[model samples]
Target: MELITLLLLACALAMDSFAVSITAGLSLKQFNATTMSRISVTFALFQGLMPVIGWSLGTNFAAAISRYDHWIVFALLCFIGGKMIYDAIQQHEQAHCINIYSKRTICSLAIATSIDALAVGFTFSLLEVDIVFSAFIIGLMTFIFSFAGLTIGLKLGSIFQRKVEFIGGLLLIAIGTKVLITHLLT
Candidate 1:
């Protein structure tokens, strides 16, 4: 694919990570560089790596992957989002105890948000596109968007307070639903 086309694809793929990053950011009790870096890097890595993995898997497993990818994403996101909402509703000793900084939580969010990029990578394979270039672009775009998302979420959390997690949780579930609906429709 052309550079512009690849950039557009990257942007499209990064949308989920962007939103997820925002949700993760909403759970932050305070600003922490480690949290931002961890979230951004993990998300970028997953978003970046999934495409290559998909391209490598190529056409052999495309049907199998697509058949259940949406479900997996939906379940993962819903579970996490639900936890966030429930935790937000409950009394947290620290106001924000969602543990968005935990390795497991971050990985789950990253994987849930980046599954579609895997499908994109599969498409790249079929189109005989440069996997390296496209994957790099996707990763780079995800990093930028994820960081921006975190920043936005932080700002929003500061303004909204107390309900940021609730709203973020709703958004996460919505994103998951969107993926499920989109896949089903297609």
Candidate 2:
């Protein structure tokens, strides 16, 4: 793919991570640089690594991967999004307890958000694209977008407070649905 096309693809792939980062930011009581770094890096790493892994797997298994990748993504996002909504509603009093910083939570969110990128990597392999270059662009774009999303979400959450978590949860579900619909339609 052309560099411009690859960059655009990177942006497209990063949207989920962007949305999830926003949710993470919204759920936090305060912004911590270290925490943001961890979140962004984790997301970037997954977004970057998945494609390489997929490319390594190559076209031989693309059929197998594609058969269920969307479903996995949809399930993960829905589960996490539902949990966020439930927590927001059930523990409104203790809203600060949402642990967005935990390793497990971060990893889960990263994986959930980056699953499509795996498919993209497979596509790259089929198209004979340079996996290293494509993965780098994808990871870099995700890192930038994820960081920005978190920052913006923190500001929005601070202003909106109580409603932000619910909104964030809905955003996640929406992203997941979009992914599922796009894949099925295409």
Q: Give the winner by TM-score.
A: 2
Can you tell me which runs of candidate 2 are displaced by over 4 Å?
Answer: 59-98, 158-186
Q: Rate the local accuracy (lDDT) of all candidates.
A: 0.71, 0.72
Worst lDDT 10-window in candidate 1: 157-166
Query: Which residue pairs of candidate 2 clash?
Result: none
TM-score of 1: 0.64
Could you tally the backbone clashes for each prediction?
0, 0
**Tens-digit per-residue lDDT, 1-186, candidate 1:** 558657655765666667566666787767888779879989999999998988887657546666676776677556656765775576544433446868998898889878867766765665567888888888999999888778877777533333545664565566567667876997
TM-score per candidate, in order? 0.64, 0.65
Give me the candidate number with maximum lDDT: 2
Q: Candidate 1, clashing residue pairs?
A: none
* Clash number for candidate 1: 0
